[model samples]
Target chain A: MVASFGPVALAVAIATVFGLLPLFLSGIIVPKKPDSVKNATYECGVETIGPTYIQFRTPYYLYALLFVIFDVEAVFLFPWAVAYRQLGLFALAEVAIFIGLLLVGYAYAWRKKAFEWT
Target chain B: MSFLSCPFPALVCNPFGLARDGIYGLLAAIVPEPLPTVALTVLGIAMLIAIIALTVMSQVWVERRAVAFLQERLGPNRVGPAGVLQSVADVLKLLLKEDLIPFKADRATFVVAPLVVLVPSLSVWSLIPWGPGLAIADVNVGILLVLAIGSFTTLGILAAGWASANKYSLLGGMRVAAQLISYEVPLVVSALVPVLWAGTASLQGIIESQATVWNVFVLPVGPIAFLVFLIAGIAEVNRSPFDLPEAESEIVAGFHTEYSGMRFALFFLAEYSNSLAIGALAAVLFLGGWQGPILPPYVWLFFKAYAVFLILVWIRGTLPRLRYDQLMHFGWKVALPISLVTLGATAVLVSAVQGTAA
Candidate 1:
């Protein structure tokens, strides 16, 4: 078992070294030529505008929260998919219960104007 | 019986074979018994590496051609006949291109992001069963494993965006994270219908059960689950309509804006490979993966996966991307409710049928 892990460990080490070595090499070899124009935010070469970092709307975060809930729900599907055959009718019934709950959540989100395009 | 005609007859005299045996003997000297398992482990790793690399490369070419055809144009025909060598040419270009990292970027995380994208993408394949008796592991929680590993890709995308220190990249990453997370709910709920029917999370078990009748035909809710899986998959891979993160017109390549050359290619490779991975998962979950007459199992697996990929490419070419709000709305309000209801109904019907069967 120890021997079995040797190659995998080696592969990971090699991959990590290759992935990171280039960054250090480039930093050392490449000339540092910083200028105001070079550091400017990219927006098709217009003059300096207002502050680039502004607080974004809270709606985006709400969307993200909703996303987390749904994503967790999606994660449950994989196991369900794998075990679909054996679960048979009883299993299906259980899923129906799960889905019913999810639907309620969905309906709640919908009525709250979550889908409205602003 | 026919020693002269038999291939590899020289195996009787092969020194390398002897040397290999000698090495095994030496290892045996250190630890007794189970010599073959060590050799098998090495072979398995090699096979996995080769399979993942080959799949990623071939799928890239397939996607380009499929997208081109959908758009009514020839894609990469100049590189090789029917663009067969397009991916190969791309590999060379990526190899030759100078890898550039922005000075302002988070050095460690930016570099780590691509690895994050790739490793999880490849790892998910460990659970997929291409054919009967063909898989890396036949775990009972194979479905859960896939879901768990697949979600890591979103983290990788976010890491890329945040590490880049570019506003567009940050916006793109945030959008992708949100989209993937939201759509994941319906996708999972819908997927549960199949699990409820199958009763085991082993992929091989799913295929074996479906051998007689595919779930698509058996359950009305199965198709609904399939649709949810497809849409969620598209979002997961950031392909077309849901590809808000890499919206070239607006975000200037999104999370990967500051990346160049090989580093950028890593993201590209991950994108194409993830597309294939998700497509394959969809096939396995809903389309009866490698479940067909006559052809070999792996061939059927590829055919189904490629078919899904073609559909993705078609959508990419045919549809316009949804705005951020519209994207969120559709997932939360539309797909989520429909899928949830579908799951509930499937469960009720399945139980009633079981009552009858019992």
Candidate 2:
């Protein structure tokens, strides 16, 4: 298993160097022109008001919860799908029940407005 | 041409395989055990980097000119012939520009965000099968690894947003976190249809299975899987129509709002690389990757990837961006279910028709 991934490890290693080369070069080749005003956070031309890192309330929180549940469920689906030809209809029944349960949760979330963009 | 005389008639002739065997044999005969391996490894790395640099340069130029053609304008015609060297100039200017960091930003995370964003795109390229015997990784769980690595972009985007310490950037980051994760379900599920039909998650395995017939032509679920995969893929790359995070008119450059100079260009580079990854995957999973007659297999992969990317550009030119609510609602309500049903349908239909028969 580890031997098969040798080429993949090499590929990632090569890509990391290529990807980070420019940022490294930019630091050496380009001079920094930073100043207090120039480095301040942007908000159009107006001076920024209020703290930029204040506690934030987001409507996406419920969706985030939904994502965690569904994403985990997908982990099982992928393997089952890959091995479907080998797995008999009994395995299909198991996947169907699992997917059916998830769909119930999906509909429940819908009814509960977990996906609402409030 | 020399590799065409390969002995196995049942298996298609693989030029890459022949070249690899020839070089390895020559090097091993001339040198000791470890040295030949090291030399070949270094050569492969050099070739990989060269290919990436060339791909990025050409992809950016093609996209700009294509989008320009769609908008009825000449793009970068002032630069080298037909503005082909425009990206080279742009890269030089970006390198020359002063790098800036916001005063209140989280210094470590701010510096690391672009690198994180870039890794997923780079990592996926390793596993994608450009042709038979052509993938760098060629591992068993190749497609699974792709979905796993490709999901890391959200972390980078959110980090950029939070580290920037700007309201709009945070909002943009939040949108990306939601958007990428949501679209991912459909993308993964649609990809599952091909995996289920082909009975393998190795990208090369899927491509070889399509040697006789491509996935897009399979009855019932093939076209549906392709359709969902295309939609979610466009969203996954943050292209137009699903570009809520980069909605410039509303939030101003999205998560990278405060980035400038090469740092910003790195983000841009990663985004384009991700788009290429999507095109490559779509080509492999749907368009009979490297399966056309007559041409070298790798060339077919290139042409197919280019055609898919051009379709993306066309859609970018034609479609209007979706509203934020509509985007999220549609992902959960529409795309997700369609992909799931297709997956289930493919399992039942394929099993009944072909699984037990085998």
Candidate 3:
């Protein structure tokens, strides 16, 4: 398992360094001049009104929670798929159970209107 | 037919292997034992950077020209024959411009966000099979890795929007995050259809399975999965129609609105590169990567990839930007349901066929 990650780890390190090169170069190559007005938050040529940070709706969190359910379901399905041919009918029934449980939760979420946007 | 007479086979089968092996040999000569491996890895990354830049540049030009054609106008015909060099000129201009970050912007996050967006786009190419021997690293769970890595772009966009300290940017960033994550579920589920059908998650194996007939021909479910994958892939990459996050008419420039100079260009680069990467994955999963009669595998792979991308370009020119509510509704309500059903159907079908045959 460790050896399997060798190439991936190496690739990531190299990619990170290469990816950052241009960002580093930009600081050196380009001019950096900042004034108070120029650096201020952009509000379409007008002074900012009130606080900039707005509170997002609670519905987004609900969407995220619903997403986690499906995401985990997908994760469990991956390994079952790879060894699919070798697995007996018993294993298939287990997966069916797994999917059924997730769908139950999905139905619950739908009834609660977790999917509905306010 | 004598093997000696077939001059094109070597070149066609593995065009990149010679250069890659040469680099390895050079590393062997210069670097000591353990260091050579790392050096070769670094060289592979450097080559990836070059490839990303070239591909992104061409994609930008192609997109611009195609969109222009759709609009009844001539796109960039001045600089180099047919204005192919226009992207180069654009990049140079972007590089020379002053890098600016608003004072209220989250200083560190704003500065680092572009790289955060870019690295994933570059990294996903590692698992992609260019030809027979051209894959840099053939990880067993290639599709999973691609999905996991591809999601980081959302993090980057969130960073850009939140850091910008601008309302529009913040809204754009949140929209992007929501849209991307929601679409990701369907994308992964749709991708699983091919994985289940091929019985291996490795992209190369999937391609090999498609040798006789591409997966798009896999009756009833194949075309459905392909369509779902394409739509979700488009959203995951934050392209047109699905690009509610950066709707220029609605949210100005969206998440990257506050960004300027190379920082902005990096986001642009990441966008097009990710577009190509998504297109590449779609071609591999459905259209059959590097698999065709005649022409080199790499050539075929690129041809198919560009074909997928051009269709995206056609889509951008054709469709109106989706409303944010519509985007969310479609992802959660429409795409998720279809893909889940398809995955279930595929699993049942595969098991039945193989079990009966056994």
- Identify the leading candidate in terms of DockQ: 2
Cα lDDT tens digits, model 2, B223-266, are 99998999999999999989999899998888999998888988
Alpha-carbon deviation at B77 in model 3, angstroms: 2.5
Off by over 4 Å in 1: A1-53, A70-108, B1-39, B356-358
What is the DockQ score, from 0 to 1, of model 3?
0.61
> Considering every candidate listed, which one attains the maximal TM-score?
3
lDDT of 3 by residue, B1-358 (tens): 1221223657557655687678778888877877776676667767866887898899999999999999899999998999999999998898888888898888999988998998888888888988765677788898989889889999999999999998889989988888888998999899988888888999888887787668888877899999999999899889998988989898888998898888899899889988889888998999988877667777778888889999999999999987777888899889999998888788778877656222
The CAPRI-style docking tier of model 3 reads medium
Clashing pairs in 3: none
TM-score of the A chain in candidate 1: the value is: 0.70
Judging by TM-score, tell me the better candidate of 1 and 2.
Answer: 2
Give candidate 3 regions above 4 Å deviation.
A1-3, B1-8, B19-32, B356-358
